[model samples]
Target: MRVVSLHSPAKVSGISTAGARLSRLPPPHEPWTPLLIGRALTDEIVRDTPLHDAPGLALCAWPADMSPVGQVLLVRERLRELGARVVIPNDLYHGFVAAALDHHRGVRVGAWLHAEHHDGDELFERCAPISDAWRCVSERGLARALRVGAGLDIPPAGEICPACVEVPPACAAPSVDGPLRLVYAGRLEKHVKRVMDLALLADELDARGVSFTLWVAGDGPARLDLARAMDTHIRAGRVSLLGPVAQHDMPALLTSADTLVLVSLSEGMPTTVMEAFACGRIACVTAGCGGAVPLIEHSGVGVVVPTGDMRAMAAHLARFAADR
Candidate 1:
């Protein structure tokens, strides 16, 4: 028996890393035959691939970005070639495991949804027919997934170990003279992360006499538009675009930051927010943002605001800066 976790290389940055942190296992003392089909998993490319002696526990990850059907079928065939029966695929962000489910209906499939979805976007529901079990990263997300009339697995958020997270040193409270160091990491896609909103919020903060410098990490097609939105701030040394910092380098950048801010339209349990908490920095996140809401609320690690309310966010940041 082997465990094969499948995911796309495209997801290596944001989603895959979070999933790995939640479910990755340690390597065994004995050597085993770990099959390789495509690029390695995001976080632990070598050590934590989950090819244990117990096939049920082995994690085989593959990507389904460009051609979902082809990739899914390829994974199914690969698993069959290896004589594996049970395969668990994380179906949170990508939604590409259905083709694999279709071809391998007899296999015990463990599927999961990473966040709450639209009524029309029943991702977990679509795969339920072929799945042996269903789970979610957060209980709230699981409840919402079940509301769509689908069986969802609700696990404790603490199941993800904090010690497993790799982060930088904790940041200290800001002083009156020092500008507030803000950060927005992860993919720059506008659909989910809504990064353009950060540019607008920067302008508002500057107008309100808030001294702050925002450092945006990661890259995407929206890079040009984000630059256009922050034209003034960029010139005035208020916003810096640290294009695509390697995952290993993220800890240093995040540790220097006073606050980790994400104003996404939607979110799952954002690893970046948890990354901030691990680094002992504050998180100013949007309210009702899937799994991240509870992490921030329960830990008292940061503040939560209404989605799209730039004014309230700016006020909150300004007040936070003043109090510090």
Candidate 2:
């Protein structure tokens, strides 16, 4: 079967990384293709390697100003050209396009929930009616879908398709001798990710006299502002901004850090936490980080603090640092 997975640009974010991995790891008998929309990144790791060489993947740059109807038509034509029998839209824009294609006799559409927040609710309401199936990145996301389905009078049928990562044979344990090494890998955005809170967390940690080093990987609109906010830390070598590390390099990055930190205001299921687990590293996340909270709590993988509570996060990290 030919499957087309539609997603946003092939950037250094979780969705883009997951889409790239899916393109390369399809069933032997099924030719799964990732139809990435928008301009491609020129990053050495992202644009030059896996995405370019991955089999059955197609990259296309569409005009950003294209009308919604036009985008849908373009996607429909692309699907026909690719002979895609199954369409999975990983984002809301492509979800709408996939929903429109549900009328096609030979094609099946699946609505994917990547978050458990307001946007997830919106996606299900707008696309679930026409979607032949529902898929979510985490159990929390799947539950959210069922709840939304109940409200929308849609059937309760969806599967949890958690984010994936290739586990290495062995990962080096975090060193017990130096300053606590923490890494945050994701888009530096304020709204959902609340990346600005990192600045606050740094301040709290400094106030507590916690010895630590934070490495932030990934870039977004808030990058400049976050850099400004952490200027003192950056100058003091307490924080470093490693912009947009590639998916392939993530395991090494995670293995190097004692703990992966995510202080997002909200999340569906962060792929970084899964990668951290695969690399034998724990996580310190906010309670708003959907599925990650329960996973951390149940597994004792790391710590979970209330949303926006930098003081609590600082306290937990301080304990880890002191204990280590």
lDDT (10s digit) by residue, model 2, range 49-126: 335555666754557678767767777777778777888887746545644665555787866678878877887887
Q: How does residue 256 of candidate 1 score in lDDT?
A: 81
Residue 221's lDDT within candidate 1 is 69
Estimate every model's Cα lDDT from 0 to 1: 0.64, 0.79
What is the TM-score of each predicted model, taking all chains together? Answer: 0.76, 0.92
What's the TM for model 2? 0.92
lDDT of candidate 1 at residue 292, scale 0 to 100: 81
Per-residue error (Å), model 1, residue 300: 2.6
lDDT, candidate 1, 143-204, per-residue tens:
66667753444322223212136655455544456898899987777877788889878988
